[model samples]
Target: MLARSIIFLLLSLSACPLFAQQKYIMTVRGKVKADAIGRTLAHEHIVTNFIGAATVVDVPGDDSVVIAKILPQLLRLKGQGINTLIECTPNFIGRNPALLKKLSELSDLNIVTNTGLYSAVDKKYLPPYAFTENAAGIASRWEAEWTNGIGGTGIRPGFIKLGAGSSALDSIEAKMLAAAILLSRKSLLPIAIHSGSGQAAISAFEQLKKSNWKPEKLIWVHAQNGTDEERAMLANEGVWISLDGVSEKSWEQYAGMILFLKKRNMLHRLLISHDDGWAVLENGSYNKLDLFENGNSIPYSTLFTKLLPALKKAGVTESEIDMILRNNTGDCFSF
Candidate 1:
């Protein structure tokens, strides 16, 4: 047993980067640590609006109203011991480095931001240039966001995000995905994909594999909505499965899948996130807007009060939760 353990350790060490180091912009008191990883909501739009890049002329609100709306939620998340959040807001709307920096300073929450283009449900809503933009153009912008920082603040993004159309991967979206993979490989950044229902997760992975991208470098988000067989396949490839439940109807629906992965010793690569945001008021307005008006109301408190407790009740150990939240998240963006 001792010899076997030693061999395993050696192999693990060999797989890790030779000059492994903990790289992060800011750190919190109790939560941020190089070794910390558990219960990370691998899929969450920390600050985002439903309309996204589209003009929301109907939404009655300015920047201040949005920030005020989401402040409480950020405060709540801070209190919840949710060490880190991989905010999957792409460059155009969701990338707010200054505001994120302020939130980290004020809330002490580790907000890992992402870079890349968004794949909207409706192509008609996308930017006029987005449809005609070639893969190289998208990739150049993505690379700029990572190296030079979004909008020239020099605040580098932590990960790359790619999404398909609400229904399937369209030609333009596929080009964007391929471009994202190319840029991510060059920058050594991990890629996260929005796999909306059906075999989206599997298809995305298949595309990545075809591009010769390693599975470990990709995170297939919304695994909770995927079929059992698809989830199992992702687990086998050592891909991270984000079993987001916040927006999903029932968190319990994912419990079985979580248990299955755990039983199969695949829990290390799993993540759980709420994917929820500010409440939609009766008048059809969203509260909790951030600096860029892309904010949500699902504060840290929600994670601690509702989400964490629910998972605990579902038999998730604190250590395991830490792995999902802290360790796995850190690993995802180690590049």
Candidate 2:
């Protein structure tokens, strides 16, 4: 009887969800403990091919030139104390896990990639099959990337990324959201959606509620585009408010938004970043990289050089800043 009681107690503890799960975030290199991702810029892009999915061609060969152009910026970011960067360029829009992995190795920074389709800009970035495939089918593709690895590179995605074009979720966007929810449920990865507007963020949140998905799993990327009321409402609903797109011009506005949320005790729900990246300009016979005209003269340094100082001037404590840059980011991306 004593042996049986001990065996049952052990089995019960093993079956508990808390004991059964281990928390970690997937990086281009591999998985790391959640606490290890220090001072993460929650959203940024390495390189984006805006040539659209139909005309975009993967120019095979060494990515030396592209790496040459972008590597210095990443190294500088590492110098600025940013330990991890969440690369937000979705698959068709130049989601290169292999390239990200190479950059990560070269710079010694934790770079994360995503596994989902971008359906924004009138579905220009989406592939042909995205239209014909159902939600389950689309989800299966993303889930396979999470389980196995992206495109056989053996590097997995850390989260799900979806793009919405407007306030009303169009058919393709709705389908993509459904697929994201499905994949998130299966893989335990957070879903970050590029909301085109405030209503779009609300719409996505409502849909998640209808699907019975946890609001904490949904990140409203580009939440800076939304109003304070909208941001407050969604933050109250447990959605991760990603106030990305910080730049030299926008740091003050971002600081104000952060303080507003801080006043409401919603600082823990915020994620901040510079939506800074390079746009691949493909000519007839050559490709060139153009710094995104997002108002940051520098690539990834404004958050440290400009915004944080402004927040500090406004009396935002270091621990509160850490909550946004370190704790919130790790929690949002960790599975």
Candidate 3:
């Protein structure tokens, strides 16, 4: 049956005169055709950086430290059939593009890196420079990175990211968001906002509207906490509504969200993931990383191991499943 399916796909594709002009996912290494991106985790952190983290927590040091902790998880994600993953850890708070390139090379799976700043955690996460920079100045920073490369690593970003504070965007967070919209307008890469709650998510959406940016270009991350009406409204506007609730505690909730999307006929705009990441191992050393939960990053295997079966049991069809895990995610990355 598989052989027949492959042959049928080949025959169908060969019949299309415009097949070669098809767009594909933009990865750290290069472009990838859609078919090659088998299944994707839309909002995951293969490697998370937590610099200036409040309280006491482990923050991985240099590239070696991060690679030592995250490479195994990348390979494990590949083993579990996740062909592509998006690393949403933004700048300052430990966004490492070079490490992402290396991991992609070693694991032979497509890993995408992002540009922009994160401000959801606290004002401290916002760099000192962010405080003084105007919106255009901040945008120029991201634009330069996108045009050239971030930190001289020569690794360009695949998407724009912003972390809006809970309930609203503070002054600096709002500036970063403005930069995100401007970047999207210039580069056509979609923007993902780590919104804190329903009100904050809606406020960001209103800002996007005010800026005349297409609603489709906005992705409201962490929107799972929003009311059903709010989520549906955003989904109705064609924005990507990401419900990244993939852990032992939230797996059932994740499945329920999928069922909700299916019922509302909004699965095409839905993005799902563990939102989990490999821990920033203490001291850049890998002495048995029992700290996977230390950084809110569960194993990459959570989606494939725990959630897939539950989604199936919840009456999600194979085609719908493929659309959520692969197609929607691939669409999210198509630059």
What are the lDDT scores of the predictions, listed in order?
0.65, 0.91, 0.78
Q: Give the Å shift of residue 281 in candidate 3.
A: 5.5
lDDT of 1 by residue, 1-335 (tens): 99999999988887799745554422222124445533355666545544545552233434455555565666666565665666776654444566566666666667777777767565533566677778888789778877677776666777788776445577877887888888878876777887786466677777888999988877877776677777777878978888765532354556677778877778888877766644223223444333322122333334454555777888889888777777777776666
> Candidate 1: misplaced stretches above 4 Å?
1-39, 52-67, 166-168, 247-249, 279-303, 306-314
Candidates, ranked, lDDT: 2, 3, 1
**Candidate 3: how many backbone clashes?**
1
Across 87-166, the per-residue lDDT of candidate 2 in tens digits comes to: 99998777788889999999999999999988888889998889999999999999999999998899999999999976
- Residue-level lDDT tens digits of model 3 in 123-236: 656776788988899899999988888878788888988888777777777788898898889888889999879888888888889999988888889878787778888999
Number of backbone collisions per candidate, in order?
28, 0, 1
Better of 1 and 2 by lDDT: 2
Clashes of 2: 0
Models, CA RMSD each: 6.5, 2.4, 7.5
RMSD of 3: 7.5
Candidate 2 Cα misplacement greater than 4 A, ranges: 1-20, 283-287
Q: Please give the lDDT score at residue 196 for candidate 3.
A: 79
Model 1, position 116, has a per-residue lDDT of 75
Stretches of model 3 off by over 4 angstroms after superposition: 1-22, 53-69, 281-298
